[model samples]
Target: MDYEAGTYQKLPIKQYPARELGETAEGRYWRRFLSPATAKQAGAVNYLEFCPVRPYNLAVTSSTRVLVYDGATRSLHRTINRFKDKAYSASWRADGKLLVAGGQDGIVQLFDVGSRSLLRQFKAHKRPVHVARFDPGRMHVLSGGDDATVRWWDVSEGKQVSRWEGHSDYVRAAAVNPAAHGTWATGGYDHVCKVWDARSAQSVLSVDHGAPIEAVAFFPSGSVLVTAGGTQVRVWDLFGGGRELACLSNHQKTVTCVTVSPNAGPDSSAAPRLLTGALDGHLKASVREGVYELERFQVTHIQKYPGPILSLGLSGDAGLLAVGLADGTLTVRKHAKPRADPAKAGILVGRRSRRAPALTAATYRYFIRGQSSKAAAKDSVIAAERKAALATHDKFLRKFRYRDALDAALSTRRAEVVASVVEELAARGGLSSALSSRDAAGLGPLLDHMRRNINDPRHAPQLAALAHRLLDVYGGSEALTGMLPALTLLLERVELELRAQDGLTRVQGMLGPLLAASVGAC
Candidate 1:
């Protein structure tokens, strides 16, 4: 009967603890920065803007100079140092041929990007001009100043088009709506953000951001607005009477700038992502693709910088990320290309060609070149004769060696494996034989394992029975006197577990009537 195979109760699988975190596809995508390119400036970097066309040359504003950098190589392409005072916002036109920027001299200057020559200059503000941007039509430019006023300028005419004086404090940030031809937004030190239309004399919409507004931007659709101030970044619904949508407060200091990815529009396949820079020297990216809920507004990725970040810009194709720091340093990181798997890539000999010959099917060359790795077909039939290798204890159990099987399982130092072996031995009426061992060294490990797992409800019944059998077999054995201490400890543990179970049973009995009454009321 011992040699005959008997049923072994299936036990829950034990999971091994992982030593490291698993990286997800999205995590790898955002963490693709290679070695960064650094450049020293004469003063704190104030703004960074990327060209709207191919190559996407970056315009970096620092001191009185606006330096243009090659987008691909991140090398200095040209520098425009015509400003009499510190330059502020430097923006690019849609054609990429024209650039505009404001300065502390209270003047807005337009320049030819290729010639690095000033084309037009508009001096209308009484105080320092801090914010300037091109309108969507490319025919107009907007400028805001420390005098608490926003002004519109005609690029070709070289004159002020319209001026709006509404904010009670300095206007520091502005954004042109890409969807609406005349709609734009501005934020300032008075904690107010207002949206305006070029055709209207007054602002079309307004909202209180609850803190000094540092940055304002509109989604591509022009129906949503994003404002960063204090340590919070808030999203608002423009068409819903400026109803608040989501408020993200992940930064520890004042947020300095906020920008939307170029591909984050209604027509693009990628979800809308917001990138924000803060005085805490952190850059955070947040996604707004799922249901609009307060809890869903969470930061997905974070990048740290050495100094407080003042401005951030992503290229038109979202291939380059450039950051301006308060310490007069410019850091540019390019999107790393995904590496192709060497094992799956086809083996092409010599120079690469677009018109390469296709390989034939079912040949040895084709199978060796990654064709065998293709997924199996759903309709294909699978063989059923594959056998799994048995463990050390499993081999002993198959040979009707109960005591040896118990010893092999105990040697594994795994609670689940040991419990399974003991359950199998007891089912075959071999528990007494397996537990009839002599000497302290042989019995100490088994006693320790039982003592540790005796309180676990999953293996309690089997371990409790095994413990009782062990005591009955060795209760009067005088030769094993060295094991008295171990036996005493095991007995004390068993007694503690019994008392705990009794206390729980008594508590359950006392609460039975109360539970019944509550259920009846429900």
Candidate 2:
């Protein structure tokens, strides 16, 4: 377990895999997970949150762009071109289509899903709106900021309707309880988690944490409130008549934010999930037992990573996790395996002692059959399938032994797999039914592979069909690529098409590809 501060041990989790836990199991895992790698020197990741929508959820990156990825398919749909600023906080409305985000600039803007237009702009707070959340109760929107006030915005008229200025310092986080409609809560550097009756803008309850509370939220039932920061997560039991229920300590650095599992609704048996993002560079999810009892063998499960995760959001099915780090990196991580058998893994039993992996083959065998259950085995099967596809792709290059390492890794089958991944991504937006999503605005990585096919008019008929389809979705015609040939042809085709046409004006610019490495003597 040789883990140290500021470094994450990329543990070998044969997650699906008795398969590809990592291409190099210990240091790297998926190729794309490391594609948008962080700089050696990282930045301060301010916030991380997720939309409550289904498969594809929106996450905010430091580049100020909002990235959407599908939890089920493990692919991304590029919308980095949509939000053109440094976003502080982003959230989806209860219905999932309308998205609202704010930043240090002190203005909060709402985008309508159907029109993609700014429906309204309201100045809810003056000192840079830090966070804004829509009340699931359909009452009002709650927002907090450096101004030290939590304001309630009237959703119908687009104006500030009420405000509660209580804390002496800046507000860092906020949450709304769905069960307790017309109610919400806030956490701040003031070292307090305050519950407010959203209907009245009045502070109803306040709990003091020993450190600044970086994140806060009420559990699904509104009976308990959880807040975390400085390596501890404190749960307030309002159900216990305002008693402190439990405190969890595992994070190596300051805990950034904690989100409950989307599927942990009233009737679910799976434990309540508490995901913690850390300034120490990792994100881990721990389930709550409600009564402070650990299960059979080793109850706590953790996944380590190599970035300062500032934010985390759970997909609607709780099947996927989106982690946003300070490095301007957005990673869509698969959720950890289900709880391990406590009776199988020897219990520490009331003591925080070391946890050991079974040593004997008999022990390993006992653990393996269970540890690598149908789910774990399922991961292996997926990895094997992907590996075989990759091998088939490289077969031609290896027989001739060209030695061009790049060609050895990038193969035709791999390219086709990328297309399938893209289609899966576009399917989330219901884009797979048409040619538009399959061609552009599909999976970002998959789209990269298709760019080489742009010139073939033989590919042209499909490209034209795809372009025309995209025009129908986007309602305009502009080449996603900057090349003169493509742009010229796209414009002319748009005019000639008897049916409607739509397209991108140009491919969106990348954040840092053109920049030289930094020299650090300042």
Candidate 1 structure lDDT: 0.83
The runs of at least 3 residues in candidate 2 whose Cα sits more than 4 Å from the true structure, single-residue gaps closed, are: 1-48, 70-85, 262-269, 290-299, 335-522
RMSD of 1: 8.5
Looking at model 1, report the run of 10 residues with the lowest lDDT sum: 4-13
Model 2's TM-score against the true structure: 0.53
Which lDDT value does model 1 have at 220? 76
User: Residue-wise lDDT of candidate 2 within 124-164, one digit each (tens)?
Assistant: 57778778777785445778888888887877799898889
Residue 492, candidate 1: C-alpha displacement in angstroms: 18
Each prediction's total of clashing residue pairs, residues at least 3 apart in sequence or on different chains, is: 0, 14
Q: What is each predicted model's overall lDDT from 0 to 1? A: 0.83, 0.59
In candidate 2, how many clashes are counted?
14
